[model samples]
Target: MANTSGNAYGLTALCPIINGHTNDSNPLYKAAGESHDKEVRRILQALPLNQESPFANTDNTYLARLFILNDVFFQQGNDFKRDQLKSKYLCFNSNFHGELEPYLTSLWNNNENQVREIWQHCVAFESVSNANDFVRYIKSCQLTTTLFFNGSNDQPVAEQLKALYVKQMFSEFVLTQQGKSAAELKQAFKYFLQRVQLNDVKSPSWKPGQTEVAL
Candidate 1:
């Protein structure tokens, strides 16, 4: 499947938004007359970005985004007939490492409330009551990926983050320890290794979606 290129998976889903306005009294929506598409977009926009993104909690998620597609674009210089969608769709695209099941499971497990809030406006999402249901619903909405671009090595996210941490720390060590005595340099290198704990990928490493290094 095009969705699987090595250990990476690209997920593309277009879930139809409900045709009517939400009747729920949630403050996130304008109960009087807000369209479902508008509510979905509002929820997505209010979501935290970067390290605080819901995907940041989802294991192995390299990238993900969401948007509302109200209609199709007309191309070919207006010679060809323009097409229009019957309904608006909540478009979701994700690029991640490892199998789709586990990745989606992690997403549902880690960000269930956010997922429910955003996807509730989409048709049939009410059937998603748990992780398995969420996975199944997403699969039903999934489109076959015709082409998936793999830009990085197919390594587990933890390993990749650890490698980056090692590189940065080693570079800093090289710069700061310059011109030290041989013994001092050797001792400093040992401390650096101990601090980095290169054998452990879980700690002293970059967090997923982290933008700025913590002081």
Candidate 2:
């Protein structure tokens, strides 16, 4: 119940980053002075954005992000003791539809290479060889989502995408069909319904992470 609010799942994980330099033999580690955490950040920054993002291919993923956690901030003039993290961490948070296991499986299956590259610097991540392994690894690093915000109404991503597609197509139809004859308007309306495919959520629907209108 901690990570679930209806059908939506909010996942948060803090995978401990290794406190070591990148292996010299690795092609990605061109600089001998680069740390594991720095290389992870560089790769994250180079990831494709918007429609081309890795999460775009990940099924049911509404949103996902990754970043390195270097340290906790100090509250100035506070009397409480300061917190010092034992190691830098890789922070991953994702909002998605369906169960955690399924979503994690989709994530690993779709972006295995990217996942391996980013999480290789994290502790115990080398053991993650498949979807099940990835799920277990994530759970080990998972933190309870105490206060998840349900901004997506717990709807499956396919349904939401279809809704967006229908709305866009209908709006365009309304604008373009102005001043048509009654018979012509009726014909156009039939075509609009066919094109929108109100019952079919797969075809002619908005692509996940789409940023522009294609229809």
| Cα-based RMSD of candidate 2 | 1.8
List model 1 lDDT by residue over 1-215, tens digit each. 58888998899999999998888777666645789898899899999999899999999988899999999988878479989898999999998898888889999999999999999999999888999999999999999998787978888888999899898888888999999999999999999989999899999899998887652
lDDT of each structure?
0.90, 0.90
* Error at 17, model 2, angstroms: 0.3
lDDT of 2 by residue, 78-189 (tens): 6878888889999999999999998999989999999998899888888989999999999999999878879658899999999989988888999999999999999999
Which 10 residues in a row give candidate 2 its minimum summed lDDT?
24-33
The Cα error of candidate 2 at residue 161, in Å, is 0.8
lDDT of 2: 0.90
